[model samples]
Every structure is written in C-alpha cells, then in structure tokens.
Target: MSRKKTTRHKAIIDQLSVNPSMRVSELSDALGVTTETIRRDLEELAAQQLINRTYGGALLRQPAEPVLSERHKANVEERAMIGKAAAPLLKGARILMMGSGATTVQVAKRIAFEMNNITVVTHSFGVATALSLNPTIEVVLAPGVYHAGEGAVHGAQTLRFLSDYSVDWAILGASGISPAGPTDALMDAAEVYACMLRQSSRHMIVADHSKFDRMATARFSQWQDIDVLVTDIAPQGPLGQALASGGVDIQLAG
Candidate 1:
C-alpha cells in the first residue's frame, strides 16, 4: 500500500475503535479524504477481517491479543524509570506478590540486582526465574494453567495456591488505567491479578503514561483497590484529574 493509504487505514481503525461504527461520508470528512477513498479503505479493512462491513462504513472488530514480546519492546525507557522507582518501595517488604508484564519484568530486574532477603510469590515463570538469580530472595512459583505467550500462569490453581500465603505488597501491571481502575487484555490473567490484590496488604500499580485514559476489555480491580500508582509521568487532562481524586496515590518516576 502507499504511505497515504497506510496512514488512512490506521486512522480509520483509530476512529472505529472509539466510535465502533462510522459512515463513509463521516470518515471522509474527518480524514480529509474523498468518499471513494474512504470506501476503498473500508473495503480493504473488511477484507482483512479487521472490520465488519455495514451499509456505509464498518463496525470495529474485536481487538487481537496483544503480543508480549512486542509490549516488552515498547516504551523501554519509561518502563525502566518506573521500575527503578517502584523497586525501592520493596526495601522493607518481607513478602511480595507481583503480576507479569514488561514493566513488572523491569521491576524484577531491579529486585534481582538491588533488593534482597525478600520472598516473591508469582505466577510468572519468567519472573520466578529472574528473581531466582538473586540468592538472597526466595522465589515461590504459583501453579496454574500456563499462558505460553505471556510466560505466566493463570486459573483456579494459581488463585488457590496464592491463598496459602499473605504478602506485604502486590505489584501489578495493567493494559489500561483510568478512573474506573486497572484493566488487562487477558481474562485469566486479570483473575490472577485480582486474587493477588485481595491477598496482599497493599496494592501498587506500575504502568507507563501511555496506559492512562485507555480502556481494556477486562477490568481487574477498582481505583479504590489501588494503594499507589508508579508511572513514568504525571497524568494530565480529565483522566489525570479524576485519578488524583480517586484515592490512589500517584507517584511519578520521571
């Protein structure tokens, strides 16, 4: 496709994400394109099963599973900053429960290199192995159904296993964060994180600024459930204001 067509395709997808359904005339006006051009884009997207074709434009398709490796590559510096800031909070904690994600992986790296004499209970195979590199930290693996792509485990077994232990803190990562609270793309993973939140004394969410104001398919916990939020930047706009008043303390890593 041409550069213009590629850009138009992305714009169409973005608009459809927010509105779900749109008309060709509306899309053309918004994108500053001719109606025929809009129609061609819609047709192409529909052919790819990225959208459901309607009379005029199209309806949004369900979002695909976000790849873990791709997520790990995105916002690298921001996640590292957030990780460094959050790792220090573990200084006095004896036991911790952590969820799996790129940000959390950064936290694990910090813990492995800096923190010591802490016990980590996690469903992430990668996290457990990472923490195990530090002889001072005791790593406990939660057994459950494995999600190979995510390098984590989630299901009834994981929840039941976590119930056997109480932790000083729960460090979680999210796909999206808003006034409504933290959300994840995967349902089973969300369930495991929800269990961790309930089983810990304090819940701290670690996410980058990009996650703010976004909505994910599955909401795992409410804003009130969060004790602290560690991120790369201070949130701005209405979502930021709402989060500030929503009771969770926000900490900027930058």
Candidate 2:
C-alpha cells in the first residue's frame, strides 16, 4: 500500500473505533475526500479484515480489536514520545503490572533501555521480551492462553495469576480515552486491566492524542482510579475538561 493509503486506512480504523459505525458520506466529509474515494477505502480496509464494510459505511471488527502489530505501526512517533514520558513514573516503582497494548509495548522498551533492577509483572509477550534486554530488570510473565496476533495474554488466567500479588503500579495502554475514561476493544483486556488497577497501588494510562475523545467497546477504568496520563499532545475540548475534573495529572511528551 502507498503511504497515503496507509495513513488513510489508519484514520478509517480510528474513526470507526471511536464511533462504532460511520456512513460513507460522513467519512468522506470528515476526511475531506470524495464519497467514491471513501467507498474504495472502506472496501480495501474490509478486505484486510480491519473493518466490516456496511451498505454505505463501515464498522469496527467485532469481538477482538485490530491486530497489535499493525496498530504499533500507525502512531510510531507518538507512541515513542508517550513511552519516554511514562518511564520516569516507574522510577520508584519496584514491581508494576502492565497490560498488553501497542503503546504499553513502547513503554516497556523505554523502561528496559532506561531503568533497571525492577521487576515487571505482565502477560504481554512483547513487554517481557523488551524487558529482557536489561538483565537487571526481572521479567515475570503471567500465565494464560497465548494469542499470536497480540503476542500477549490478557485473559482469565492472566487475571487469576496477577490477583495473587499487589504491585506498586498498574501501567496500561488503552484503545480509547474519552470523557468517560479509558476503554478497550478487546474483552480480555477490558476485564484484566480493571483487575490490574485494583491490584496495584497506582494506575497510569499511556495513550497517544489520537485516542482522545474516543470511546470503545468496553471500559477498563474509572476516572477516579487513574493517577496519570501520558500522551504526545495535550488533550483539548471535552477530553481535556474530563481529565482535569478527574484530577488526573496530564504529562505531555515533548
């Protein structure tokens, strides 16, 4: 796919993720493209199984979220910046339970490269492997049914395994962060992440600004439970108001 097509495809998926379903004309107007162009884009995205083509629009694929690997490729710079900004929050944290997501993987990589002598409790294969580069940091992989697409396991067994230990922090990434708070497209993550928040003393959510004002299939956290939010750009509009009202410390990565 061309770079333009890739960017547009990401936008389509992002839009569908926030709205659940979007009409062709709506997307065309929003994206500043012709209706026919929007139709063509929807058809291509559907063929890749990234979205479900409707009669005149599209819907987010049901049950599961988009492929993790594909997602990590979308907001590369933003994820990296958010990851860097979140690393310091882990400075005094001895043990942290982290969820599996694209941005969380970036956070793990940053932590491995910058921090040490810490223990990371997680079900994400990517997080564990990223932490392996720093021998001083212990990597504890939670046991569960493995998923090839996510390269992680955030399911019933993973939740059970993590419930046994109380950690210094629960650091996670979200599919969407709206006025209501953090949400996830994957049910496995939606449930397991809430458990993580309960099992830890502090909670931090890492997401790019693209997720601002977006809502997803399931909510993983309440506004009162969140300690901090790290993102590339400062959230504005209703998202900004909500974060402020919730007393969440917003950190912008430069």
Each candidate structure's TM-score, on Cα atoms with residue i matched to residue i, is 0.76, 0.75
Candidate 1 backbone collisions, by pair:
none
**Displacement of the residue 39 alpha carbon in candidate 1, Å:** 24
Candidate 2 lDDT tens digits, 114-222: 9878889998998888889899999999988887887888667888888998999999999877777798887787888999999999999999977765557778888
Which lDDT values do the candidates have, in the order given? 0.84, 0.84
Give the C-alpha miss distance for residue 85 in model 2, angstroms: 0.8
